[model samples]
Target: MKKLYYVVIGLFAFAFIAYLFIKKEPLPTYNVDRYYIEGKENEILAKFLLAKDSSVIELDEGHFLLGQSLILDGVNNVTIRGKGIHKTVLSFKGQNKGAEGIRISNAQNITLENLTVEDAKGDNIKVMDTKGIIIRNVQSSWVGKVSEKNGAYAFYPVLCENVTIDGCISIGASDAGIYVGQSQEVTISNNTVFYNVAGIESENSTNVKIFGNEVYENTGGILVFDLPGLTRYGKNIEVFNNKIYNNNIKNYAPEGSIVGQTPSGTGALVLATENVHFHDNVFTNNKTTSIALSSYLLIYEMGKRDAEEEKSPDELGNGVASADKLNDEFLKDKKYNPYNRKIKIGVNSYSNSRWFPTLNNDFGKLLLFKKPFQTIDILWDGVVSPNTDYTICIDNTKDINFYNADLLNDFKNATTNESLYKCR
Candidate 1:
């Protein structure tokens, strides 16, 4: 019996050791490269800072622990390349000086390809006021558990023109993974984004195209928003042929941020943007709704209103006067449009089983209060401008289940009258 017990204990210990060995991720093999930089972090940073126009900086296959951000300012036609996405890693886990991992400002014709940047204090890659930028085959992420202390954006481009981000992988951002704001002529295609608050976001931009992306497991899949105090308004956007599903991750954005208001289980939320189109995208397993078209008033006024200060349905007459007053006060700038107009949804595939809505924030609670029975596929907060011709046009009404939550009427006359919102 003693001999048998000793054999059993030895076998169990050996099995446990083998399991741990198999579970560990193997490191990539490094090839000898004389031309690539394979030294300390300061050496690599110096090469980037001193790079001239039309120069190329190649990184070797190794992990670099960086403490400060790398800046490429006022340089034109620069290219930064690496051995492979998994081979060359730049980690800012102990970052102490700068906010971003890489910052490119006031440059033109910059290209970054084939690398991984992880765990920055702020955004991983922030390109501002640049023209003709290309980011291809790059990966940006935050390691370990997802938290609000992670970076806000992975690939962030703002106030730029002629931007293209293709074949990139982004993960674990507290805010949007791939974000383009106040930029024109942007194309974001062939990317994979997940485990962020919002996977992909286009805010206050024009002439944008988002296609051929797989976006999943975020708080919200995609967002097209026009905020109150921005330099430009969002318009002329197109989203097609993407796979957006299962975006039910809990929102981890910090308090008082605009994206903190986003509810989990939301697939797409279009807020106060015009001339937007959605076609040929596949939506699946979004627990709350597939698509929601909302006015900024719904988020700013009604969503922000304290729940303790409740008004009876009888006290609010049609709810138009309160809404109008709030709109006038919010849209005082006269340049920002507060209503969604000329939006079209055509031929998009939707597959979502009925599930409970999220109760993390006030907006989700409001959605649950409005429709307590089951989930929704397409929801429109029925708030339109009387001055302009606003319409939510759908091509195939029979295939989609639509709900018009009469937010302006305080849910008094909420209906599924799809014919009333037919394409004109």
Candidate 2:
């Protein structure tokens, strides 16, 4: 009787397992939606039009003049899907004036999916003044960067808003891999942008977010800049969860030129902007600082001499702002360049080092530059303080050349406060 009960329980368990197995769905061998289209189609393999001369547009493979700039205009409520990237093609054989693979303007509810745009003398995809824009599984590559020499063209969007960019790949761009300028409420996420002068750039826009993007190996990765007097102020930008690495690119362009190479040498930079958030981003292995924070420094650096008080306040907050001019009469009042600016690394007591003395190999802190800087000050004592002896006096009676000057100048201009008290 006990053995019969045990067999009954085992059979019930087996029957339940078999029922669950029969109810399960098979795992898909493949998802056709994820497949990339390939190969050529009939005709010259030019542009494919959607809903020719209708409010609703649907595309098939054929040589068609696409977008509003071409045969048709006002593409409203359009669903433009490709048969496959291989089946359809955009022939920009003689697109001399700002030709794009798809030039969308003044449209609504626009959807572009599963397309490959190549040989765009300009931008592969250009959207303007559109609402509800969606670009999925899109790949775009330009012939090269177009400047005055090659005609001003790029895979770019200018003066559009409420944009969403995802799962996109852009390469070999002249200006930027992904360029979003003067747009509002935009999101550029999960995109691989590479091999361009500027990786991903947002200029003079607001309420924008850049999240989870791989921006690498560009001349400069992710620049947020406001051109002087452009009338566009970059505000409320958030850059987070992005890997920005190796963003230094050489600029042989002549000084005082903006077009050739984008300025602000940084892996990521925030310049003269406000309400910007930089969080959880990996910035490493760059020529300049991983991130540069600079604002209102220019007003102090280059304010006019006459309006010094108006521009820069004195220590007492009085009108005597020309202490800078007074310094010229007393001592050279020139600002020290970054090379001579005493680079320090790490915190004090824990880890800190002075650059002129030696490679300290630590982060900078307040304790590093508290004393009157002297070469012997760094040599005898690691740092200078009131009680410490001026060690430079023991080494050389004439001068301790501090700032890497030429030997001729060093001998003529050697300074000793004690011996040369009357020289001043």
Candidate 3:
């Protein structure tokens, strides 16, 4: 009798499981309304001019010419997407007053995707003072050959946080193609940047990871920079898996610009930053040094001698107010450090570079005096404090040339200290 009761209970459990497995799933709900707009210029501008929170603006595939910049400011959770990158185009060919093709500011959770922007009066796409923003599958360009008159930055995001820019193309910016300044927690990956002064630039930003990108045919491929008078220092940055080659494009940046200080054919330039890691990257055919390391004093003495602080009072509160003040109060203040230290270069492949450093300025002449046969794969201006030996490690770099120009003492005596830069 007990065995018979157990068999009945097992049958009942199996039947209940079978009933649960046959239940149906609910269909997806489409409650949010999508507002699609196309055609005549004024009507399209009207819709975007007054964008509200949680707004979704879809632009159809076509050529759009606007006289003014399209702005989506002070909005949250807004999505401005196009049908396709190649299908939809926004042109600022006739723009005379606008500063960008699209400018987004003071927002959160903003997503901009699948659009092509060209011929802007200034930057193609710029986002500032925002958080939780995503810029994906976008193409930004200036319509003609690379020129100084072109915009300074293509995809410019400044003072932002938690931003990710992926699958984008930037071309023909006189400054940096993709410039991220004074931001943090950023990821820039899978982008193609070409024909610009600097392909990708990170200035005074922290916790950035740049990888899986193709950067070529620019003056300098990648620049990790820190200028004075900007809020916060740049640290904890990682750059890997990038194809940086043939960055011999002529320097088209206007005179006195920060990028103009960059030598043509530089693969990567790290200036006045700390804790940067470069790993598993390809560097080839660059006419200059494949990798360059220097302090902010190198370029700061070049030409940007304007004593007048560029940042306003509000912006000063955000970043360092003055370069002089930071230097004066160096030890007392932990917020600013203008020295490039603790850089790790690991497992990178470099070939056919350092051909241009021989022709560079006074420092280049000193490098040529050291070794005339081999081009310098890595060039470090040996500018450091005696008390604190900044750690720069280069590990497992095979068959690559290197130079250390001790510029602090007028480049009189230099050292090939291979033992000092061992992998840590």
Best by lDDT: 1
Candidate 1 residue 294 Cα shift, in angstroms, is 1.1
lDDT of 1 by residue, 1-424 (tens): 9999999999999688546422333211112222223448888899888999999988878778888999999999999998878788888878999999999999999999999988899999999999999999999998877887888899999999999999999999888999999999999999999988899999989999999999999889999987766677779999999999989877777644667667777899998898999999999988778898988867666533622265433333222113323334466766777889888887799987654455555555666667775677788888876666656888767767778887877888788777777777
lDDT string for model 3 (224-328, tens) is 987665667788899999999988766767654667767776899998788899999999887668899988666544332433445332322112123334433
Top model by TM-score, which number? 1
lDDT of 3 at 181: 92
Q: What is the C-alpha local distance difference test score of each model?
A: 0.82, 0.46, 0.77
Model 2 accuracy (lDDT, Cα)? 0.46
Tens-digit lDDT track of model 2 for 70-112: 2223566665665555344454434555556567777666667
Query: Clashes in model 1: which pairs?
Result: none
**Higher-scoring candidate on lDDT, 2 or 3:** 3
Error of 1 at 264 (Å): 0.6
Q: Estimate the overall C-alpha local distance difference test score of candidate 3.
A: 0.77
Clashing pairs in 3: 231-319, 231-320
Error of 3 at 384 (Å): 1.7
Q: Residue 7 lDDT in model 3?
A: 100
Candidates 1 and 3, the one with greater TM-score: 1
